[model samples]
Target: MSEEIRETQQQPQEQTPPPAQETFKPRPPGQRVTMKELLEAGVHFGHQKERWNPKMKKFIFTERNGIHIIDLQQTLQYFEKAYDYIADLVANGGKVLFVCTKKQGQDIVKEEAERCGMFYVNKRWLGGTLTNFQTIRKSVFKLKMLKKMEEEGVFDQLPKKEAVKLRRKKEKLEKYIGGIENMNRLPDALFIVDIVREENAVREARKAGIPIVALVDTNADPDLVDIPIPANDDAIRAIRLLTSRIADAVLEGKMRREAVKLAEGEEADFIPEEE
Candidate 1:
């Protein structure tokens, strides 16, 4: 028994492995947002490795299980940069058109744009909507005419067939150009949700010399836009977060613009008109 005890004591005891090294360490909370929030929102998720754009290599942090992981640090940096740019543009009396026609983003884009009092396109992107402004304006005028007729009871007096035809035309126009009816001219900039999906809008905006700020996924080319905020463009929550941030910037800018206008008005009021 003593020999057995000595042997047991001499044998090395099984060593428990140190706690598995933590793969993800959340940074301290940030002012606008924290890395943890972004993680929870799945902003770090990217397209499959096979579908990634090579031009977006720098934005990618790594690959896990054949999926590319976006670098949230870069997302934070670029998002801030885009936010500042948009705010300054609006404050300086520049207009921004919100373009997001994807089903996942349509309602969100429309709501945010309306919240910020900016123009938006939540439906189909008509070819030459920007390039052919005169034609689009005509369509908008037609829509207004149709609405006026309806309000004035002209549709009520018309034969059923005629009224039905006119109503269908009005609905079609409203479905397509209703959002941009108030857009008198080309916007100074564009805030796009998915560049790949809204390629025509991007192309038209580029041709019209309008600067673009867009949320780019790994599958899309980031170089297409002037300011690209790398993020998960498909996730509804991610889209809401990004669009809301941009809308906030627009609202802040509008406030600044109003302040400037009020200051100008006060200064003018204080000045005496020629007696």
Candidate 2:
């Protein structure tokens, strides 16, 4: 079959055609995403069939020509479960770490993590970041110290050569651990973009007993993650949509947590009238 013919046959007639230029606008926290939105974001498109992993067979809807089509219905179903789990986790004072080292997803990962007020590793995933967290905490402390020194004007008073050296050191730390400077403890869970590309992160999370919620493509094993939402991991639009949804869930969870705190505080402050 011709490529154009395969594409047409794969898409549904009822689905809305993508815009001339697709721009992502994140939905509000607690808002639900629909299958039609997923379709428009191209979440159904998977890797080529030849690159498919046998373990991902259950998530594959079908093969059109040489490409695999992800089951967006399954994606939506699993995504709901993942969303609930993440929201519940955060609601109970749990923390999540976002890890997406791929060039296509680095900026999106950083933005989403910040939007949800979670720690992230977009530039690179350092070994043992989770399993060996004590060591990572030391680096985080050092980064904070450097930042404090700069804020205190210590660097300005130092010798020029010493100041230059410290500045270089601070820049390196900022690149590696800047996103995690405030992450004093290991995260309760991990949100990974591509499991295959970030295998080290998956391994470290497993070793550290942290749950993982990840976007699993056709070429990756869904079983590696605790909650795997199967989708097109290579597409920027798909990544943006999925990550934004996850961030919204986290934001919702934070709101719920604050509400609970407020209720408890109000109850504690309530005093019975004179009887």
Candidate 3:
């Protein structure tokens, strides 16, 4: 056979379309609370409350109208469920607003949020943060204006001695103006540490059609939250563990997304050649 014919025969034929990739369900977030941990928590704090009845022997965390309490095992299950729901939301491209009135709770929640690369409102939840995103954008715009003025030599036009003082004033104003960089965009969901204390923020989130995932103690109403995690709001250990579980879930969801992309790429590469 001629060399040209041999080379032609060796060449691959037309490729067939790749098969549709299978969708993967991501793992749910939050660590499982073992029965031992639940019992220990009950023993440590369950008896402290005068209202706690020893006969009931089943104390779970409860929340209603923003108040919180930890008394029952059912609360642990609630936390697990809430954590999974939040994880699913985050994995599916939803944003979350983290709100907490207490400094300790805010700090704990903020740390977990940062770990998961999500935004939070540890400070006071500004009114209309969700409802009136344009107003917040205007604030951010004002900051940008100040920065532009400084860069364009507007401050330099001032008397040499007064320029430094003017610059200091500008810096002070910018410092206290609050964060409005991403303010124009409202979160897809809200995760409140103390739903009662930050009720206004929660209400705004609700009005904007944002789903809420909140830590509900006995004192707060569970009805307020779309997904309520019943747990000890006062205990640092409990708070940290619960928040971390949610963060981990978000991370896992992100990983699953990346994995899906990779699988699609591999399948494209392996398409069979059509004769």
Best by TM-score: 2
Please provide TM-scores, in order, for all candidate models, with all chains considered together.
0.86, 0.87, 0.67
Candidate 3 on 1-275: residue-level lDDT in tens?
A: 00111111354568753321222233333235555664444322322343333322333444333332455456666667766676667667776666665755666676667666677676666677788888767766767777777899987898877878767766754543333344447777887775667889778877888888876654456677787766555555555656666666666556666677889999999999889
Candidate 2 CA-lDDT value:
0.87
lDDT of each: 0.85, 0.87, 0.61
Candidates 1 and 3 compared by lDDT, better number: 1
Ranking by lDDT: 2, 1, 3
* Better candidate by TM-score, 1 or 3: 1
Instruction: Give the runs in model 1 whose Cα sits over 4 Å from its true position.
Output: 1-30, 272-275
lDDT of 2 by residue, 1-275 (tens): 11111122265779875531132343543356788889988899998899999999999999987899999889988998988999899999999999899887888888899878899999988987888888989998888899899999999999999999999999999998988988988899999999999999999888888999999999999889999999988777788889988887787778788789999999978967689
What's the true lDDT of residue 78 in model 3? 66
Give me the runs in candidate 2 sitting further than 4 Å from their true place.
1-31, 271-275
**Candidate 2, position 72, lDDT:** 89
Worst 10 residues of 2 by lDDT: 1-10
Q: Model 1 over residues 22-139: C-alpha lDDT tens digits?
A: 2212122244555777787778888899999999999999999898999999999998888888888999998889999988788889878877788999999999999998999999
Clashing pairs in 2: none
